[model samples]
Target: MDRFLSNTVSRIDAKGRVSVPAHFRAVVQKRGYSELYALRCLDLPAMDVGGLDLLDRYEQRIAQEDPFLQTADDMSFFCHGDGTFLKLDQDGRITMTDFIREHTGISAEVAFVGRGNFFQIWE
Candidate 1:
């Protein structure tokens, strides 16, 4: 697994675009992914970032859990949705849309924290 490992702070441009850390970009590309998926975190005021494979692994785990298990509804409805997909530009940056920006309260800058299999972008 090409895990994202590191912590980096990036400046958000006026247009709401931020350059992904070089290490993170390299890991994603090495895993054969050209795009990234993200969502407003369910329990936290941050953005959850990952690739398709991470989402797949997540769904696979959820599939085995009992439907009535604790927090299952929250996971199935709130946290689990078709995440916003953004293509990496030539410079390895992704522009956050208004919806994402508003939900995350992200403004002039952000902290990108690696979480092994994924990462989180915080205001």
Candidate 2:
């Protein structure tokens, strides 16, 4: 399928790298994305992880709002300011940096829960 489906639990190595599930990697590749964009969830102890399309969608929504309003700036701050790019290595792994760890509370392990076009990283 072209969408992220199912879930996977992966262990983090000493370098804080963890393999993105093969199925998820395939979906990402099929969508022509070279890296993943991860945004910390506003109300949850998790991260909303996806590709460029996801980030673009957020931008599109922000564009629909009036730029002079505080709401637009707030949305931009939450979606872009709190987001980070995750690059997949040769082994389809990504480093869980402080941006992710602090938001998800993920330490030795992480739970990758698929959410259709995107997925979430949880502790």
Q: Largest TM-score belongs to which candidate?
A: 2
Residue 30, candidate 2: C-alpha displacement in angstroms? 0.7
Tens-digit lDDT track of model 1 for 52-115: 8767766777788888887666566644663688788998888977767788888788889998
Q: What is the lDDT of residue 38 in candidate 2?
A: 95
lDDT of 1 at 59: 74
What C-alpha lDDT does candidate 2 achieve relative to the native structure? Answer: 0.92
Task: Put down candidate 2 lDDT per residue, 54-111, tens digits, no spaces.
Answer: 8888999999999999999999998978799999999999999997888788999999
Candidate whose lDDT is highest? 2
Q: Give me the displacement of residue 6 in model 1, in angstroms.
A: 1.4
User: Judged by lDDT against the true structure, how good is candidate 1?
Assistant: 0.81
TM-score for each predicted model, relative to the true structure = 0.83, 0.96
- Clashing residue pairs, backbone N/CA/C < 3 A, model 2: none
